[model samples]
Target chain A: MWDFIVERRSQLLINGFNHVYLVFLAVVFATIIAVAIAILVTRLPKLEPVANAVSAIGLTIPSFALIGLLIPVSKIGDGTAIIAVTFYAVLPILRNAVVGLQGVSPTLLESAKGMGMSEFTSLYKVRIPMAWPVILAGIRVSTQMSMGIAAIAAYVLGPGLGTFIFTGLTGYGGANAFNNVFVATVAIIVLALILDLLLIILGRLTISKGIRVA
Target chain B: MADVATAPNAQADARERTGRKRGPKLDAEQLIELFGIPLIVVVGFVAFAIWRNTATLDSVETNALPWNSIWIQLREHVVLTAVGAMITVVIAVPLGIALTRPGLKRAAPVVVGVANAGQAAPAIGLIVLLAIWFGFGFWTAIVALVLYAVLPVLRNTIVGLQAVDPTLVEAGRGIGMSNLMVLRRIELPLALPVIMSGVRTALVLLVGTAALATFINGGGLGGLLNTGITLFRFPVIVAAAVLIALLALLIEWLGQVLELVFRPKGI
Candidate 1:
């Protein structure tokens, strides 16, 4: 294992970075889209159930199935992977953002209005800030989920450490098969932890002191 | 992670604890799921059947896209999911109970924290590694699936039991009930909803993971996917994808119904 690591250190680092980068970009895009849709759901209460149903049904669909469906239209490679990862990434954050924004007290909105804030301003300043921690929690979950989804998306020739696992499988009887699988799996786990810790730090920096939870 | 299904249970808990104005609202959400899922399943099945009948298949597609083979794959997927889930519940719930007991209670957080960290590892990576270690087959796939799913059930079991009102447990003991009696009569019933919700989440996770079983020759609808992609058969690919999605949706709906039907009322 040590020899394997020494020989493939740069290759391992590149794959690991691509995996993290892939998930990170998808999660960021997902957070934005989900939060915006969540804001819409908050504004139009009727859209709430529709949003809920979509997210609930959405999460249940297998990533493998989605990848299969995507191939004819999207062809193979990073686009399919990104689209699939972002799709799964959206559901958790969407659910969380809706919950987070709704959990923001109506009274706070009323007070913001009383202070002469517009609806947009109230959302921008008061509601979103109050909801930031919960949304961030959603982002963390989204990031974790996206990590797994991106790995699966790699089956489509997508960029990631997931390629190593598949390679390890195809070379099942080879001497380095276990090493390949073990190294990629461990690297993905480590990256997920680092991302989660980073999200916690983000929470510390972004969340309002008054609303922040220990 | 909430895994989507747990969100409703959390809502239910909030409603129970806070007496929130959420009544009838969730009924509508449930109604959408209840009515909508089966409809989509039927539609997808019909559409796929029509497409399968109408579409011209090449020799490779003809061999790979038979109805009997599809049924077998579907059965394999379900069996893999169901067996894996049953094993997970059997292992996770009891272990959860043991961990929450007085002597082992301190280990709860330690276990959950470890499991949470472990969950971040990709499912395919785990499956591949396990296959390499144990040799690929149905049981290896099942083991990987169980390991992947056990965390949600275990965490939920612990959380559900812990969330039970202590005063109620004391009240049962105060009335001269034995520890086992109190657990059966008081704690388990109250925690049933939360626990079932977790199981539902696990069930959904299992179904999704089982689709990947084809990778290891464990047999499932994923073979259609694997075959399609390698063969570049678009018809087989679309049918497999649709069927898998429909099956997952149907299972998810069943899980929600199970949560409603099995959760003891009068909580």
Candidate 2:
């Protein structure tokens, strides 16, 4: 593995960058949509269950199937891949965001209002800030999920390290098959770990000191 | 004439009372979900079936459409999911229960952290990694699925066992029941719902991940997906996706029914 990485340093770096880029786009798309929907449903209350159920069903569809379904509409490329990954990312982040928003104490909201803060201001300043940790946790979940699913995006010709795995599998007994797949696998795992650690740091730095749990 | 006036007031009062009682409850929406999911599967499958019967794809080089090859892949998918779920339940449940015990308490965070890492990592990476190690087949797929699905079951099991009413366990012990006896008689029963939810989550996860098995020639509905994608056959790809979604929803429905069966009586 070390030898393979050394030999293919430039190629690996490009694939690694693609993997991160694909995941980054998908996560950002999912977080925006999920957070928006979560906030909307939280206010509506009655729609919360509907939103949850839909996301649950969305979550059940395999990454392979989703990419396949999107192929016709989006055509085989990064477009289809990003859309599928975004679909998968939406569920966890949406669920977590909803939970986080709902978890905010009612008394806290009341207190914000007592201070004469506008509803929107209180939501922005008090509610969302308090809900940030759980929402971040959701984004972290979405990031990890999208990283894996992004590999499947290779089916649609989406850029990622998954190209190596698929190519290795398709070329089974050929030379360098094992090395290609192995390196890609290692790269993906490393990426997942690094991303997770980044999120952990982001969580710590963003969350206020008084509210920080050990 | 007087009855008309009184009737209008009565109707208004009843409407106000019911509206107040309903408040923000989403009972109607929940009912729709209860009924709507199955309705979707039925409608979607019926539509797909019609398309399969009428829609001809001369560009297709693969086997007949989705249904013709579906049974083969469906069997593989179901068996793979079942075996994976069984392994997850067998391992995760016990470990989850054990972690709640006195001796293993300190190991909980470490075990959970490792499990979290497993879940957080890309699933395809894990599946392919295992395929390389085990030489690509059904068992390899099962192992991969098991590893991916275990976390939810394990996490839920721990949470479930820990959340069980402590008083019930203490009462069981006070009656001279052994620790194992208390766990079995009191704790497990109370934790059953949570454990079941975990199992359901794992099953749904396994069902989804099992699709990736086709990447390693493990053979499932994903074969259709991969072939359809490769050939750019629109009908085949969409039909396969619809079927896979239906299968997942049906399994989740089955899990819900199983939950009802396992649920303790009298609250």
Best by DockQ: 1
- For each candidate, the DockQ is 0.53, 0.23
How many pairs of residues in model 1 come into backbone collision? 0
Predicted candidate 1 versus true structure: per-residue lDDT over A1-214, tens digit per residue: 9999999999988988899899889988999999999999999988877787787788889989998899888989999999998988787678778877888888889999999999999999998898777677777777777777788888989999999889998898999999999998888888887888888788789889986555
In candidate 2, what fraction of native interface contacts survive?
Answer: 0.44
Model 2 C-alpha lDDT per residue in residues B240-262, reported as the tens digit of each score: 88788888777766665566567
Model 1 chain A, poorest ten-residue lDDT window? A133-142
Candidate 1 chain B, poorest ten consecutive residues by summed lDDT:
B11-20
Off by over 4 Å in 2: A103-116, A208-210, B1-33, B59-63, B98-103
- Give the candidate number with the greatest TM-score: 1
- In model 2, the Cα lDDT at residue B251 comes to 74
* CAPRI level of candidate 1: medium
Choose the strongest candidate by lDDT: 1
> What are the Cα lDDT values of the candidates?
0.82, 0.75
Off by over 4 Å in 1: B1-26
Question: So what's the TM-score on candidate 2?
Answer: 0.88
TM-score of each: 0.94, 0.88
Give residue B127's error in model 1 in angstroms: 0.5
